[model samples]
Target: MALFRTSIRVFHSSTRKMTTSSVTRAPFLLSPNQVSELTNSGHTHSVSLLDSTWFMPNSPRNAKDEFLSKRIRGAQFLDLDEVASSHELGLKHMMPDSQTFARACEKLGISPSTHVIIYDSHGVFSSPRALFMFRSFGHENSSIIDGGLPRWVDEGHPLDTAAPILPEPGTYGLPNLKEGAIKNYDDIVANSQHDPATNGHVELVLDARPKGRYTGTDPEPRPGLSSGHIPHSYSLTFNLFLQKHKTKTGQEYSTFLPPSEIKAALDNAVGTAEANQIINGQRPVVTSCGSGMTAGVLWLGLQLLGVKQVGLYDESWTGYSMRPTSQIQKTS
Candidate 1:
């Protein structure tokens, strides 16, 4: 009953100004309240709220195990590591080709028409990657649930402990494979700014790894990999942008800080003048991370700021450092 009332309220408030593009593009960061209202308002048929939760291999908490224990009502579990076709390629969570991705989408009950809303068990982690992946495949109706599972629970939304109910498999075909959505090794090598002093490049590489890993002062989390970063890549630890906020119910959750603050931090990492010019997609931005996981976080951050040309290094450092011809640079 309460949800019904909430849905009615949302309808009343949003109906007046709702347009085709508004629904089509839908806000990238969805609030828990808005999600609940949509679910209860008979608006869930076309929506797919996925639990895109993934944990590091060594982490004690298992994403699938936890999703099985409890998750948002009408949500599906999408294991980032397992959903793609990267297993045969030896790359961790790298995207598969369009046909494979389309098949995986069918299995998940997602079509090109489905509106994808992703969240993660961790406050703000793997969901961005899933959302980006969807966009890469021409799904424009994709968005991320802000603050993710923690915020959803903190807001007192309903959860189902039972197994997720799967819809009949849906058919998906890539209509608009957004080129330059992902930057592969060859793309990186071609675009890399080897000598920053002499080369005047507009596109900049943003590495989302921690400072220690970025500088090679700390060993990589994955063994058998060198500890360094791509040449001329700027390091902006993904977690550094997450700000703590309290819910109405007094529970704390993580969210990206305000745009101004985020812009400041980004400017500090990249040159202030350069950062200013990167706005509204004017300059292309390439993001990377340890294993292409946290890179999505940074990618999403740039999108939130309305930077148009953001691209993810699909395999990130894991693939780069393994290449015999790749150049690894260390600050120290």
Candidate 2:
């Protein structure tokens, strides 16, 4: 029993620190000052070449940063959109398989310990989604650079336009099997009616789709998926918290967000008109979306906030939206 207890502690410790290496991460992300220490002499380690909302367009390229022509030296470029969808059109940019992720990270020179920050050409569209994905996939040390590239460029920070050189690929070894931090449709369904056989508690479901889609006002972006949200799930668009676009230019990608600012976005969202949930202390979250892909983003945020006992509604709106109205929400 003593041996078993020690082994269990090690397992718990690993899960807790899954996103980190020997390097310690600022809890979630503190004020920008916390990481300002990263600027030793003049350099950032593991920078992202994202174009999140804050990047400025002092020149024509600044608009939407659509070209990503002004990236930081040594930064890795992970496409803000379609990293997952490029191959499996079925999953709307859901977390790609481990092998696929490995290849992409390898191509980008990301490692288990890389400090990842995702920004978009627009302040809000896809960067937060990517940051959330990294967390769920177990890169705990990652952070969103505050204000992203626009802020940096506006500050007259240096930008590099050269194509990124490749680094030796690092292992992106996410397991294929669902583990402690993931869940599927049946898991939700079996527990939907509050079954005592499993005697396990079903989690609170969170829908990351647009409010219009959550309430059936908007058609799903993907074809054939049903329109409504899952039973008990509430809608909250990740983009609502993203920074506004500075221009109408085509979208490219840049890098980073301020942790304090992102935290504020989340804080203001609780029970607000833009967001539909009032997450306090109770009711552990189970994130969901049209096809279970974006839901992972929501799940990722909750994990960052230190919510334990969370899971993903794997089928999300797609599987449940197709169900007969009578079967949508099962009551005990």
Candidate 3:
């Protein structure tokens, strides 16, 4: 009943001007008073993350025992079993095409107005890919459930075994371009050279790739790519932040180190690099890794810490390697 009212309010409010923040945040986060007001004004629809599918079984799931024996309410399972393609695009499970995104959304009853939140069994890799798809489409307020469903189940949330029912997908009311909050490949290179404060809001350029890759000691994931880290990018591989012991009193939640702990780790890395930037500089941080994939894990972590200007370098190494003449500093 409350959701239905909110949906009506959103429709009415759409007749007036809409701010970027209004569309980008989950609907429930909006004040209840504000939501009621929108409903009173006659908005037609409101969207929430509860509508999207959650893919909890990705590459880095816990040992079979630690896996999600229980589930979250309203979640639908999406397996990575033999990768399928949409139409004849001929892509793989790892790199889904735009058409594949549209079809998947349809299969799950996601319209342009539906707020979709994605998460996977793997900590970072698969969820970022789904987040990228939400950005590609015009859906607003799309986010990956950080730390995936394992965290949710560990905390003893309600589980729903019965699968959700879906109505036919409606026509997409997607915007032409600005509909999604995504940065392009070229934009990444241009921003790498820009001053984050003066030119734009840039969070730190943290690299979530392995130290070997960041220091030029390893080959890249994609074929025919030069091996090295991006200039001025700091390394913070996905493995380091994830604590292994859920039972230990000191460290739990596998990922998301408390800020005090993260501060010390960042300080050590910054000192090693000889960069004297503030230990807790309040810059919005962007993360990069091979082909712009792993970096999403870091961005999601920073977002958990309440940093507002988080983003991913969509092209990442793919863009850096393409540069004709670029610097490749091998940090000690």
lDDT of each: 0.79, 0.49, 0.49
Q: How close is candidate 2 to the true structure, as a TM-score?
A: 0.62
Give the candidate order by descending TM-score: 1, 2, 3
TM-score of each: 0.89, 0.62, 0.57
Ranking by lDDT: 1, 2, 3
Clashing pairs in 1: 281-308
Show how many residue pairs clash in every candidate, following the order shown: 1, 20, 17
Query: What lDDT would candidate 3 get against the real structure?
Result: 0.49
* Candidate whose TM-score is highest: 1
- lDDT per residue as tens, model 2, 5-57: 11121112213432323433434332223234454324353433433332211
By summed lDDT, which 10 consecutive residues of candidate 3 come out lowest?
5-14
Q: Candidate 1 regions off by >4 Å?
A: 1-23, 87-89, 196-198, 245-253
Is 1 or 3 the stronger prediction by lDDT?
A: 1
Candidate 3 wrong stretches, greater than 4 Å: 1-24, 27-104, 112-115, 132-143, 149-167, 176-185, 188-204, 221-224, 245-253, 259-285, 322-326
| Candidate 3 residue-wise lDDT, 202-292, digit = tens | 4357777788878877866656667776655678786654444352233243434554555556555544222223323345456677655
